[model samples]
Target chain A: MASSIHDLARHLNISIGTVSRALNGRADVNADTRQRVLEAARTLNYSPNQSGRSLRQGATHSIAFMLQPHPGDQQYGEPFFIPFLIGLQAKLAESGLDLIVVMGAPGDYQQERLRRVVETRRADAVVLAWTRREDERIDYLTQAGFPFATLGRSRSGAKSYPSLDLDFEKAGADAVDRLVARGHRRIAAIRPSLNLNFAYLFLDGYRKALRRHGIEVDPELIASGFINEAGGYEVTPHVMRSKDPPTAIIFNNDAMALGGCKALAEMGIRPGHDMAVTVIVDTPLCRYFSPALTAFRPALEPMGQRLAEMLLASIPAFAGPQGPRIMREVWPLELVARDSD
Target chain B: MASSIHDLARHLNISIGTVSRALNGRADVNADTRQRVLEAARTLNYSPNQSGRSLRQGATHSIAFMLQPHPGDQQYGEPFFIPFLIGLQAKLAESGLDLIVVMGAPGDYQQERLRRVVETRRADAVVLAWTRREDERIDYLTQAGFPFATLGRSRSGAKSYPSLDLDFEKAGADAVDRLVARGHRRIAAIRPSLNLNFAYLFLDGYRKALRRHGIEVDPELIASGFINEAGGYEVTPHVMRSKDPPTAIIFNNDAMALGGCKALAEMGIRPGHDMAVTVIVDTPLCRYFSPALTAFRPALEPMGQRLAEMLLASIPAFAGPQGPRIMREVWPLELVARDSD
Candidate 1:
């Protein structure tokens, strides 16, 4: 938010470069002039864009990770990002790239923060996480031709972008198949909010699995909310209290599943025995849960490493891509079957 | 990372200001020179420091948050940082200070990473979170006379620095008092690794409370670990199997408490019924725990806000301090009693 270096220079009645040298305290600048420049800078409240100066020389040697809340969700306690970030940074460090995290508020959703960063050229290559289906950010980045990558894929028309995401549809189908094999007729499902593209994609696979087994889809059995502990707690009772309560449940994440277990315990219901439960994405804490969770553990560190590699490779100087290499990666889900399902 | 623009100017047979002007793409610079300068910069792989140019001006208008793994502990899933960071960034935003997060690895512990940042002048003022006692970073920053703040207080001598931390010792005593009042004769405590100042401070309060209650402190009842869910699971069984088992348990954090409860559940032990449980901090998930946890809630957002405020106020230009104003704050913890303990 530097008003203008030109204005500061004009006020000092000096050439812009002399003003720069004076403010920068370069050996060539006079000491008295440097002091005058500092006083003027303080008076003007001068603040230069750090990245602007770096980008002028062609590279910043830094990867920008702009952290933003997922649209329509203020899910605060999802412990996924930190480990993912740590992994990404470790990978980047080998190439002498620093990872600078720029955080954004819920109000600054939809790549509005990223747009500013790109304009300022704060980082050479930007990395976006938790992509949505039909993401506008993906479209904007592709159109602008900015070097960037995402942890999840976006449904953009024919434009190739570097991205990595889970094969959630397959994971969803696998979960349903496993629950059905356990002799469960009535099944309940808790999905992430419908706004996220993954939620619907997951449900689509779930529906196909039910169809394969010739089970009619029951609209009453489906519940949707934020995929956290509270979401599971609230949805469990509604689904269980239905006219035909399901004997089995599938949670979108371990957080919701854990919450479901607590709800079941409160109602004197035993999971895996009274009500079969399955969760996607196993967390370390899940192992300590009673009636141990049947879930999928996505290799986060590897994913992070892969994402960084893909992003680095996509940079024109790195791999010398031909007409923008897609660098697509859809990781398969790994199942860890515990007693819960 | 930038291999010097001065060398580039000498190599190109141009004045330093001309190289700067050309690299920055000022209108006065010739187009041919700008192209030649860009090609040379690419060949040299010169990456300018974003803050270096600003740092010369006496301020970067940036506040750095160096994210490091707590020493001797690779605790990854502490959901505290994101919310705490969000709050700090929000507070800093009002003062026109951009938050730059520089993450560090366990191997780069001590003040190694921070030393590099300081040498680079990456930020005007730095913020350290989750500080340890006898912290080398604190000592170095204090000795260097750098502007900085800590989320937790350090055990440094009379020379004070800006800091805000939870009064864990008081919370530990309060927890013991509550459990003792609930007719628990033998109570257990799970502290963070003794290497951390908090563990001993909390234990100090615990011992004081037990003594106040006229009960003998059983050394076997006190345990320590990484302070995550796994820590609680590992220590719960050992303490429960002791000759004089504890009727009540006070876990350092909710994650450990949840794990402790799970450990009990595995052994057919019901928390609040068979073993009273109290956690030091209340997490959102604690509300759903059956025989719910009694915990102390440290207002984190406000704490972040306060830390930022204190750090900002300590900046000499902002507050015109006589010397370095050593702002210190020890936040009061609020008790949230549920079914457990």
Candidate 2:
């Protein structure tokens, strides 16, 4: 179980260089010697170290998924990644590839982290999440000619790359249309303060939906919060304090919505009955809430599996017989209605 | 930014073998030649690939953490790991080492995963969680002479190893004592059906505490769940249907407790008023739940940091001036009294 190449050479009573050449299948090594070396290696359970093998093959046989750091010392924004990672890992396993999660360092070191992973040849490909509108990391990976796939779409890299993005824009507009149909005129949206590509896309659809209804989009009705429960708790009252507060509100995530609901309960405003609420749910938190939340649920596990497949398609070694195809897909979401809205 | 060793050698008008020898500081290479190669490598922005360098040094300079898979196809049990991972990555970064999360495959493939990580030299050390009583994984690592640290204590392996464990035994007893003080006699416990070491330790403490008060242990009062919300929701009524039902219940985790609370509400029973409730909290879920839950909070982020420190202390390369020391510690939990109990 703990045998090495040196041990193999010693046990076979052969020169170290001869054993290496025989194992590496060099033309100079005799066939009989190669067979003997292989048999001994199998018997000794001598698994070649990945470092030595990767050096010769120039492939790590591992894919890295960058876990983006949130603002400050906060935890990653969503619990959805746990299932997503499981799915990604399962798919990668089919190709005999290992999935390594590379955590982004705090603050602006994210780009540096990506560069190190690429420059050091730690992985053959990478999967990026928490994409920004103008992601320098994407641009860096693209210009460096490193293989990568993204969880969200970005408008940064010059060359198109494989990406699996949620239909966030459609979800946003649908939320607005649903509220408008329920006889709500003033609608509010709570999004992350960060300049994420999805947040911008969501607002685009929300504003467009308002215009389609001939309703004016008010600046006061749009609020930005940190992407956490406390952020939602703190911003709920601020948005409610507007001169003419919105009767209906849509939160960017379930965690924030949970906090907003708690804040509303303390303010004596009952959700569903008094103030209509909707959330972009990724976890079961909304399902078990006191008043089950109306949510747009994305099938995260399947999406994660697709993300891995798309990434593999872009890597020439893992691609199909037709060769590598850089794909771009917008995953669909299902709207589940509950008492909250 | 994408310079390779071949490009450097071609630019310097030297043989590739000569350049390699100079960079690796071989005795055969002259000092002047080595100095010239180093300066040219820096000027070209050439970063040595980790595979080649690690083969020579016998070190990957990376740590692998095993994210234990839960039962069936369920997501990893808790979201508390997000902050915990962030803490670990930050601490590892201090030593110029990277943290790579290795996801355990479904079913009984965990030991195989650990073996691959070690045999392939993918990481210099490992961090294991979801420890079981007499865990074979621990025994395997200890026997293989691999550096590792556990998040929970285990009664496995011939030699001692570094571990940072929670005081689950005390927490279980404290919960019972607190309930007893509040005039409760029949207390039910909901633990994971899995044979986790913590669950066993927790139940041991619970049983001892009930006996301390001269109360006989009732088999009907103990319940087992799948470590998720649905598991909690499903088992709540079953435990309540006992011939002589318990007046109070303690859930192993917050997600299950949240589901149990919902189930109680549907049955016309309020958590704090009709039945006392307590949870071993790892996330912010219980704090924001209606009738805020009584919980024991472990400082997860700092605990993660400490776990990293302990693991590094065991690795000779990362150890302090005094050399590697195998440390074992039990982390304390703070009981937060909420409205639920």
lDDT of 1 by residue, B1-341 (tens): 23678878888898879888888779999999999888888787564444455635567777889887554335346566666777788898888677888878656663766875665456788898767777888887877667889888778634467888889899999989888787887999987777567777788899999999999999889888767778888888878888989999989877777778888888888887888888887776576676667888878877777788888888886664464466888898899988876
DockQ of 1: 0.20
Each candidate: fraction of true contacts kept?
0.38, 0.56
The 10 consecutive residues of candidate 2 chain A with the worst lDDT sum are A69-78
Model 1 stretches with alpha carbons more than 4 Å out: A1-56, A70-75, A320-324, B1-56, B70-75, B320-324
Docking class of 2: medium
Chain B TM-scores of the candidates: 0.81, 0.88
Superposed Cα deviation of residue B11, candidate 2 (Å): 6.7
* lDDT tens per residue, model 1, A60-150: 6788887875433343454767677778888988886778888776665637667656654567888887667777777877776778888
**Candidate 1: what is its chain A TM-score?**
0.80
Residues forming the 10-long window of minimal summed lDDT in candidate 1 chain A: A69-78
Query: What are the TM-scores, per candidate, against the unseen true structure?
Result: 0.82, 0.90
Query: iRMS of each prediction in angstroms?
Result: 6.6, 2.1
